[model samples]
Target: MSILVYAEHDNKNLKTETNKTVTAALKIGGDVHVLVAGTNCQSVAEQAAKITGVNKVLVADNAAYEHQLAENVSALVLEIAADYDTIMATALTTGKNFMPRVAALLDVAQISDIIDVESADTFVRPIYAGNAIATVKSLDTKKVLTVRATAFDAAGSDNSAEIVTLSNVTDAGISSHVKDELTVSARPDLGAASIVISGGRGMQNGDNFKLLDGIADKLGAAIGASRAAVDAGFVPNDMQVGQTGKIVAPDLYIAVGISGAIQHLAGMKDSKVIVAINKDPEAPIFQVADYGLEADLFDALPELEAKL
Candidate 1:
């Protein structure tokens, strides 16, 4: 039995999450094969081959897969599903979008957002916004899963494997192309950041976000916002840190002006070291924080910046 992993890339550059997915796949007890589907992604395929446990890399270079459209990717992955006992991908936007389609096409349920490998067939995953862990056993002939990269350590490039080009181009001719709306930021992306500094409604206004600049710069942290701040238009939705937005596990998370709602805590409680600075001594964030500072953030920001 072999396991197939889908390698995610932007056609030109490989995403770091692929390594984490490969690492998780290695624990599933099988020979691992990584599939790189794109128009011209040989370099990306070769990069996947460099991951330690991958046995072979399949490069499906096709015009239809140029954009990694869910329909095309699902068709291509489903075409090869019969050859493998398990199919896995990173539980990112790309995988979440396509993996369910593959499962539906195969008439097998997908084990979404797997956090632990119980066996070759069974897995552990989170349900109800990570409040509890569910141990799931897949009964299908082929087990399909999407792994949460943040839950596992990433695979290293300790060895090289064979790179095989897959020339089979199965085209699903369904195109609903639309204009892309892109938001670029100099600050690190929240999902990939090692440290995050988030603010709540206590920051008061959009102008108060500047208070975090010095501290974030010193710590190399991404700026994040609580739901209240986002709802107030103090920051964009992309910066939101809560149960509904991105789940982040960083080395250090500094919460300023945040009272810490249960929804917000659910998203960041897993962070290694939580530090909270709030004016209210009775704020809920203080309950979980490793270090709690009950003071005005306006006064604390400069002091924290000076110390950092």
Candidate 2:
């Protein structure tokens, strides 16, 4: 079955999640095309064309789609839904915003956050905050899905493919872009980083969080915080890692001074190599940890920094 993937991007660069979604699309087994919808996004289209498994990149360059407003994006995707048997995107904020709308417009049930593609018709996904996995088989003629990116390896941009420009794009005129306020950080993006070092309520105060910075720098890891740390004003909400926040599966996840709560485990339990450092031996984080260190973080932090 042919597939169309929504290529999410800013004006400058394609988000890393798109590559992983493309990898998932390849498993569906057919000619895969990516739809790049944004203003002055020829660069984005060109980048998508080079993804290894993609056969074509469809470009819909228009002012109405600049910010990926759900109404217009849903309309644009619906206009071309008839040709493809499956349509999928990364299960990020952008995909979560519009995939349901597209599915509704096409009059089909949307399969959300699929982690594995057992077949073109059967898929595996998480249910109940990832407490359980469900393997669902959709009978819909036109299958629509949003893939959990962390489950798939990212597609590389080493191939050359054709780029086609879409015409007569429809504008729903229901939404408009106002302004964007972005948080700028020099550390690796938490979602994309290979290694992440996170703190929690055990960190005590905001200034105490400085204990993690040095270790993070030495490891070149992104700094994350539990809901407690963010709620306690130790960091911004964007830094929070839990069920209600971003779900990440890094290669190496180091939880310092964080008692692993169920909500927090829902986010990082999938990490490849989990290291938990807490004085309390019975913290739930230790149950799933690959390497558990029972020590005060204040002392452990310095030791790790010295060794790394």
Candidate 3:
């Protein structure tokens, strides 16, 4: 059976999430082709063609797919859906938004945030806000999936796959691109960062968040905040990490003064190493932590900064 992967990329380059999704596709073991749908995205397609296990690359250079409009992108996938047994994409905002529509149009169930491919049809995914792991089996002829990139290793770039231009295309003209107002930061993107240092209500105020700046700079870590910190207006909503916010699976996660609420754990419980620093010895975060430091963050932050 053949698999078609939706290549997630900016017009200039392929996103790292796509590399990880390609790793997931490789695990299923098949003729894997990547589809790059965008406007003047040949550079992105060329990069996708270099992924180790890709059998081929399909490029649909179109103005209609510039913004990845769900209607247009879903329609584009549906046009080529018949050529492959499974269609997959990274479980990021773009994938989550459009894959469901593709599934509905194909009359198939879409398995989301799949962490493991148990078999060709059975998959493992987090459910109930990541409190439970569910094994799902799809009996549909065509399987649609959004892969959790953090659960898989990125595919290497050691192949020279053939590139094919797709002439058969579809556009619904249902939406148009508006100006994008994105928050640009010098630090690593939260989802892609290897190490994340997050603050919580313990910060008490916005100015206190500056405490994490030194630690973050020392380790080249991204700064994240608990929902409490964001709710209290200590940080921008974009910096929040929780079930309600962005899911993160970093190599190391340091929680400062953050009470480990279930809501908070849902987003970061999957981190490889967890360190919780709170004066409360019994905070729920400590239960899941690899290292727990029970002390006032005010005292600990300075010492930790000095030691690091």
Candidate 4:
């Protein structure tokens, strides 16, 4: 039996999340081969070969495969699906966009955001916005899974495997294009950050968000927001952390003035250390907090900022 992992990358460089997916795939105890499907991504294929537990690297390089358009990618991955018993990818935008199509082509349900491996074919995953855990056993001959990076430790880059360049067999025609305009930030992404500090509706306005900025800078933490704060226009939708937003599992999570709703907890409950600061002792956020401070956020901000 062998496992196939999809390597996520830009045309030039591989994303770190690929290692996390590979780590999860390694737990299944099989030869791991990563498939890199894109134009001019031979370097990324080589990079994937350097990751530990990868037995071989497959590159489907073609000019038409640029941009990893879901149509082109799904077609390429499906062509090689019969060769492996299990296929996996990171649960990023790219994987979420294309893996479902591959699963459909194979007539099997895709196990999304898997957190644990029960056995070779059985797995544990989250559902209902992480409020429930589902244990699934795949009876199909082939299995396709997407791993939640935050739920698993990434693989180390210590292995030296051979790179095997594969021919691009699929017609890489895209009906639509997705272009990216990246906003560069010194702060890390919330989902992958080790520390996170999120604000809520108590901050009142966007201007007050700056109060958390200095503390975040001191703590070297990614900034996050509650759904209520995002809806109040205090922050952008990307900063939201809740059932409707991103899931995070940071080493430390500090929530200021955020009344923890079950939805909000669903996103951050996996964090190792949770700290909640709110004036109301009855706030639900205190239930999951490792440290709780009941005080006005406005008065506490400067003190917390000074201490940090």
- In terms of TM-score, the best-performing candidate is 2
* Poorest stretch of ten by lDDT in candidate 3: 167-176
TM-score of 3: 0.95
Reference-based lDDT, residue 66, model 4? 79
lDDT per residue as tens, model 2, 1-308: 79999998996678778899999999989989999999899999888888999998999999888898999999999999989999998888899999999999999999999999999999999888788999999999999999988889899989788999998477877677789877887899898999999999999998988889998999999999998899899888899898777789999999998899888998899999999999999899999999999999989998889998
The model with the greater lDDT, 1 or 4, is: 4
TM-score of each: 0.93, 0.96, 0.95, 0.93
* Model 1 lDDT on a 0 to 1 scale: 0.88
Please write out the lDDT profile of model 1 over residues 231-276, one tens digit for every residue.
9999888788877776788899999999999888877888999999
Residue 73 lDDT, candidate 4, scale 0-100: 85
Q: Report the lDDT tens digits of candidate 3 across residue range 50-151.
A: 999999999999888888999999998999899999999999889999999999999999999999998889999999888999999999989999998888
Q: How many residue pairs clash in each candidate at the backbone level? A: 0, 0, 0, 0
TM accuracy, model 1: 0.93
Q: Which parts of model 3 are misplaced by more than 4 Å?
A: none
Q: Which residue pairs collide, candidate 1?
A: none
Which residue pairs overlap in candidate 4's backbone?
none
Candidates, ranked, lDDT: 3, 2, 4, 1
**Residues 1-308, model 4: lDDT tens digits:** 89999999987888878998898898988989999988888789878989999999999998657777788889889888899999898887789989999999999888988999889899999898887899999988899999988888889888789988887667655465667667567998887789999999888899999999999999999999999999999888889898788888899999998999988998899999999999999999999999999999999999999987
Q: Among these predicted structures, which one has the highest lDDT?
A: 3
Q: Candidate 2: where is the Cα deviation over 4 Å?
A: none
Predictions: Cα RMSD each: 1.8, 1.4, 1.5, 1.8
Output the lDDT of residue 72, model 4.
Answer: 85
How far off is residue 174 in model 1, in Å?
2.7
